[model samples]
Target chain A: MLDIRQTVEKPRMREKISEFRVGDTVKVSLKIKEIIKEERNKKKGSKEKVTEKEKIYPFQGIVIKRKGGGIRETFTVRKESHGIGVERIFPLHSPIISEIHVLKKGNVKRAKLYYLRDGKKR
Target chain B: MIGLIGKKVGMTQIFSEEGKVIPVTVIKAGPCKVVQKKTKAKDGYDAIQLGFGEVKESRASKPCIGHFKKIGLKPMEILEEIRIEDLSKFKECDEIKVDIFSNSKFVNVQGITKGKGFMGVMKRWGFKGMPASHGTHRKHRHPGSIGQHTDPGRVFKGKKMGGKTGNEKITVKKLSVAGIDLEKNILLVKGSVPGSRGSALFIFSDLNVPVNLQTTQLQAENKPVSVEK
Candidate 1:
C-alpha cells in the first residue's frame, strides 16, 4: 500500500513474497543440487527411473534484521548451524528464493539483533 | 542496444527474489520524444535525437516552442542523440519510455561525476606523498619533485599534478539492469553509477552481452523477497 510505484517497477514480481517482521523465526527453502551416484552406477538396462534430481535445502533462521527498500531490499537471517553462527543475507526481491515461512515472533527493543552474536538475546 | 536519457532520481535498496540486498539507483528515464533524426546521406551517420523532461510553455522561448510544434511534441528540457543503423523506424514525435530496456541485462550509464573543489595531489590523484615518519616536515602533501631539474628544466606536458578533479563526463559500463517499473517509468540499474541524484544519466544496453533478466528471476524464485527500510 506504500507507494509501490516508487520502489519496484514491477509489483507483480513482488507478489510471490510473503510479509514477515523482525524477530520472527522463518524457514527459507533453498533449492540445492546434489549428484545422484547410485543411479549413475546402475546399468542402462536396469531402468531405475532416476538420474539426478534437484533438492530443496530448508534453512531455518531467525530474522535478525530487515534492511533496504524496493528491489535492493535484504534481510539477515541468523541460525546456529553446527554450533557456529551462520547468518545468511537474502535479497527480498530476488528470484532465487523459493519460499519464506514465518514460524514465531520475538519481542525485542532494538531494530538490529546483532547482540545475538554475543549470546545476549538468548 | 537502445539508450534513454534519464534523470537520476536518487538511490535506494531493494530486495532480490533471493532476498539479497542490492543497492540500486532510481532513474526516471525517457518518455522522450524523437526530436530529430540524423541520416546517413544527410549527416553521414545514423542517429536519433531524443528530448527528455517537460518544459512549461510559458517558460519556453518562441523558437523552442516552434521546434516542438514542428515535431508535434510538447517542449522538453534535455535533448540527446542516439545512433542507430536504421533511422526510419523512429520518426519525430515518437515516444520512448523505460520499457525499451525493460528486459535488458546490462546497460552503460553515463553522467558527470560530482566535482570536488581544487584538491592536493594525494586526494586528487592518489599520489603517495612524503611518508609520515621521522624528519618529515611540510613536505607531507607537497609534490616532492616535478622532474629532474637539470635535464628538461620544465615539467612535462600533461603531468600528473593536482589541480581540479571531477565534474567530467564518466561512463559506467555494463551496469546490470536490475529492474524496470513500466507503470512509474522508473529504471533500476545495479551498482553505483556516476553523478549525483537528480543529475542526468544515459542508459545504453551493451549489444554484445546477453541480457539475463532471468538470473534475477531464477534467484527470486528461489528466495522470497523480504525487506525492511
Candidate 2:
C-alpha cells in the first residue's frame, strides 16, 4: 500500500504545507473567483462581458476531523457563524487553498471531535 | 486506432481548473516498441504489434527474446496487437510513448478485473436474498425461488446463479484523460480503471474501431503542395 501510494501521489503532492494536527484552530485562506458582469458596446448591439476576479476569503475554525492520506487528505473545520455552526471540508493539498495559519492548538484525546456537534455550547 | 500497453499504478484525487476534485487512476503507459506491423495484403487487416516492459534476456523465453531481437529491441514482458485503419504511420522498431495520446480526449482501457473467487448470489449476481426476520433460519443468503414449480420441472439452464465473480477481460469505455506527464511517461485518467495496481492494461483511443488514421489523413491533406512548372 505504501509503495502504491508513493508512486501515485508523490508527483502531485504539495511541496510546502504547514504541519497542523486535529483540534487546532486554524485560519484557511481560500482563493475564490467572483464573476463581474459589465456592459460593452459592440458593432451592432450591447454585450455583457463577464470577467472573473480572484479574491482570498479567510475562514477561521477549529479542525474537527482529518481524514484520508497522501494527496487525498482532507480536513473538516467547524466554526460558529452568526450563532450557527458551519462545517466545511477542505482538501489539504488543493490548489484553491492559498494558505493555512494555525491560530491555536487545543489538546484533545480523540482524533475526531464529532461530539462537539451535539454537545452544549463550548 | 493507436494504443499503448500500460500498468495500473493506483487511484488518487486531483483538483481541476474549476477547483473541483476529480478521482483519477494513474497509469504508467509506454515507451512501447513496435515489434511487428501487419498489413491488409499479408494479414487480412492492418494492425501494429507493440511490446512493453523490459525483461532480462535470460529470464525471457527463447521465442520472446528472438521476437524482440528481430526488431532490434530488448526483451519485452508484455506484447499486444492494436488494429488500426492505417499502419503506414507506425513502423517496426519505432518507439511509442505516452505523448501519442496527447491530442486524445478520451480513451478505452482494457484490463483483467480483480478476482473475487466463488461468491454468493447476493454479491455476484446481485440477488435480493431472503429476509433476515419472519423466522428465516439459516437460509438468509440463499438464492430464494430459483424457478417455477412443476410446469418447468427442473431449474432453467441460463439462471443467474453465482459462480465466478471477476478476473476477466473488462473494457471501460470513454474515460476522460485528466492529465498526462511526458517526462515520467504517466497518464492520469478520470475515474477507476479495471484491474489492481501493476496489472497490465491496453489503453486505446476508441473502443470499437481505431480512428487515429483519420487524424493522420487530415494532416496529409493539410500539407502544402509544391508548385511544379
Which model scores highest in lDDT?
2
For every candidate, how close is chain A to the native chain A in TM-score?
A: 0.72, 0.87
Q: Per-residue CA lDDT of candidate 2, range B1-229, in tens?
A: 6689999888878887667899998898998989999888999867889999979988999998888788688899899998767667778999999998898889999999999999999998788898999999999999988899898789988998879889999999999999888877889899999998899999988633454555545655896445444
TM-score of each: 0.71, 0.84
Residue B155's lDDT in candidate 2? 92
- lDDT digits (tens) for residues B1-229 of candidate 1: 4788998877666665444567787788877888988887899767899899889999999999998898678888988887665567787788898888866778899999999979899997888999787899878887788888677788899788878888999999988887887877888888888888778888887663334433434554886544434
lDDT of 1 by residue, A22-90 (tens): 888999887655566443435555544445666787889899999976565679999998889999997
How close to the true structure is residue A24 of candidate 1, measured as C-alpha lDDT? Answer: 88
Docking model 2 quality class: acceptable
Model 2 / residue B37 / CA error / Å: 1.9
Off by over 4 Å in 1: A1-54, A60-66, A69-84, A92-110, A119-122, B12-24, B38-47, B83-87, B98-106, B179-184, B205-229
DockQ of each model vs. true complex: 0.19, 0.48
